[model samples]
Target: MGPGEVAAILFGGFALLIILRVPVAFALALAVTPVFFIEPRLTPLLLMREMFKSYNAFVLLAVPFFLLAANLMNGAGITDRLIRLSQALVGHLPGGLGHVNVVVSMLFAGISGSSTADAAGIGSLLIPQMKKEGYDTSFSVAITACSSVMGVVIPPSILMVVWGGLMSVSIGGLFLAGVIPGLLIAGSQMLTVYIYAKRRNYPVSVRSNLRELISAVTGASLALVTPLIIIGGIVGGFFTPTEASVVAVLYSLVLGVLLYRTVPIRRLPSILYDSARFAAISLFCIGTASAFGWCLAYFKIPAALVSQIEMLGLGLIGTGIMVALAFLIIGMFIDAIPAIIILGTVLMPVTEHVGMNPIHFAIIGVVSLSFGLITPPYGLCLLIAASIGKIRLVDTLKDVLVLLVPMLLVLLAIILLPSVILFLPRLFMPQFVG
Candidate 1:
């Protein structure tokens, strides 16, 4: 069969599996079946070989280590200390604990780099507290879900590592690219919360005196140092991004076990087991999605896509906006990792054709996909937060929409002013820029 015909069956079959509620890994594997049977020189065994090769890269090792590190930190007393610190810093704002939730997620995002992990770790702690403080359940879930998206946009982000590894962009540069945009999103979310708090007369948290603020900062200092260790090590050439993940794990272990003594020895086994399970699921999707991407490359689908995009006569900014919209739509349906694996390679050529920087292209894609963590049909972060609060996803949509407006605006700004994404990368790592 021809490439177009095979592409149809592969994607159409995959869509059917999605409708059937099959896991993304298995669905991707199953989607390749028709290609093997139709192509004259291929076999099902090639699919297995592709899957195996995907996980062989050393850089990919960072995924599991980062996951383990986040799990360890969450099990320790880090979340409590960070929460107290956020309360001391911003809890006096109009939104009170609502503002606390945003600041804490921003801090935790620097550590975990996984939105689901942020939601699972921080949401589990604060959702109930927000409820007890008379905040609406839907609003609580909305803010937690909205703010958790920063986990993927900030430095130490697992999503950036995966995109960098796959696309051959500098992981350190991608880390630099994400910093300003992530902070902008966090700041906007806090402002949104403040407006809502004023309108609803949400209670303000008691302002922390100097002693209390110092104590909270002192307690959280060890936890706050994690992002510095990872980012500084990578940017300083002290370690590669892969090696930085190991450093993160070691630092978390020392902080949790030796310093705080909160993560007991008994909890180690369960934590390792759970981290392994989550990592397995994530890595498996990466493998399957890589195989799926291999099929696209083998058939030259991306070139075909480039031709189509070129015919649209879009300039760089227009092309960027189009790509951002496409990723946002895709993210709403699938997890970000698999989306990055399957689509990142396919779309790189499109961006390159228009004189866009690879790092800028990557940041645009990463920021757009970050919203998928909260958008419906998939919305993993939103589901996690809602489940923690015992509320429905639909109930949070109104508030979520209110929050997404500024996020979308920030995305537009990134597209229109590429310097917003490229400035820090060029300043700190000029060699990485195109």
Candidate 2:
């Protein structure tokens, strides 16, 4: 079959399976079956081989370890401490609890590197409080889900690890690139909260006293050190990303078990189990998605598509916008990791053709995919938040879209101005970024 024929079968089968509600990992694996049977050169065994090869990478080890760290933080009551700090820092703003939710997610994003962990940990605590404070239920869930997207956009991100490992971009550069955009997204969300609170007359928290701020900061000091350890260690050349993940896990254990004594020793087993379970799900998607990606590459589909797009003679900014739009659409349907493996590879040539920087392209993809966490169809974060609020997913759609406006603007900025992502990377990791 021609490359076009293979592309049709692969994407069509995957779309049908997704519409049928088959799990994404299974759908990806299943979608390639027809190509295997139809194309004489391919075999079913190749699927297993590609999946195994995808897992054999040393860098990918960071994924599970980072997940463990997030779970440890939640189990150890580190989340609670961060919440206290967020309250002290931002609670006096209009829509106090809403701002607190965004602030805590930003802080937790620094440590956890997992949006689902942020949503589950912060949403469980704050959603109820927001409701009790007479904040609209849908709005509370929407804000929680939206803010949680920062987890993946900030440093120590699982998506960045996958993108770097797969695309051969610098993990440190990607980490640094994420900082400004993540903070921008957080700032925009806070502004949205301010507007919402003003319109609805949501309660504002009393401005914290100096003593209260100090106490909150002191309480969360250890937890705050986590991002520093993970990001600092990587940027300072003290360790690799994978090593940083292990360090994060060990530090979290020390804080939870030895320092705070909040997490009972007996709880260790369950935390490990949960972390392993989530890691497996994420990693499995990577395996299948890699296999699917392999099929596209084996057919030279990306090259063909690139040639077609190149014919249009699109400029750097135009190509960047196109890349961002593609990621946003794909992210709405699939998880980010697989999307990176499948789409990132395809677009790499397009970006490179226009002389776009790898770090700049990566930040665009990561920030765009972060939106998927809140959007529907595959909105895992939104689903988790809605479930926690005991509300239908549709109920939160209005608030979710409304809050996404500022985030979309930040995404546009990243696309239009490469400096938005490149500045920090060039400053901190000049060798890798250029």
Candidate 3:
């Protein structure tokens, strides 16, 4: 079959399965099944081989370890400490708890690298408090869902790990490049909170005094060092990305068990089980998605796409916007990991053809995909937040869209000004950016 036919069968099948409400991982695998029979040289065994090859990477190990670290942090009461610190620092702002939700997600993002964990842990705690404080349930759920996406944009991101491993981008450079964009997203969310607070007359806490700020800082200082240790270790050449994830897991164990003593020793098993369960889900998606991606490559679909896009004569900024828009749409339908495998691969050639830096392209993809976490149909983070808030998903739509405007602007800024994403990576890791 021709590339067009293969593309049709692959994508059409996947879309049909998705519409049937099949799980994405299974749908991805199932989508490629007919292709094996139609293509003369392909077989069912190729699927297993490709899936195994995808899993047989050292860097992919980071996905589970980072997830475990996030779970452990939650189990250890570390999130509570960060919440307290956020309350002290931003609670005096208009929509005080809203600000706290954004701040804590930023801080937790540095450590957890899993937005779902941030939405679950932070949402479970703050959504109730925001409601109790007389904030609108939809607004509380929306802010929590929107801000939690920073978990994948900031350092130690699991998506970056997967992207780096699959696409051969520098994990450290991606991590460094992410810092500014992540902060920009958080700042925009805070500004949104301010506007919401003013219009709604949301409560603001008394401004924290010097001693209170210091105490809050001191209380969460150890947790705050997590990003530094993970990012520094990788960029400083002390560890590979895989090793850094292991280190994060060990550090979280230390804090939970020995340092903070918040996590009981007996609770370890359940934490391990939960982490494994979540990891299995994500890793399974990678396996099936990788197989599906292999079919795309086998059909030379990406090369065809690159040639077609080149015909348009789009420049760097134009191509960047196109890339973001594609990921944004696909991400709304699929999990980010699979979206990265499927869409990121297709677009890599397009970006490279335009001379866009890989790290810049990566940040655009990551940031854009992060939106899926909060958008409809497949907005995992929003669903989690809505579940916690006990509100209808549709109720949060207006507020979520309002919060997303600022984030979309930040994404556009990175696309228009490479410096927004490139400066930190260039300053700190010049070798990788080049």
Cα RMSD to the true fold for all candidates: 0.9, 0.9, 0.8
TM-score for candidate 1: 0.98
How much is the lDDT of residue 119 in candidate 3? 99
> Model 1 Cα displacement at 390 (Å)?
0.5
Consecutive 10-residue window with the lowest summed lDDT within model 1? 1-10
* TM-scores of the candidates in the order shown: 0.98, 0.99, 0.99
Per-residue C-alpha lDDT of model 1 across residues 256-375, encoded as one tens digit per residue: 899999999999999999989999999999999999999989999899989988999988999899989989998998888889988888889999999999998899999999999899
Cα lDDT of all candidates, in order? 0.92, 0.94, 0.95
Q: Which ten residues in a row have the lowest lDDT in candidate 3?
A: 419-428
Give lDDT tens digits, candidate 3, residues 192-226: 99999999999989999999999999999999999
Q: What's the true lDDT of residue 187 in model 3?
A: 94
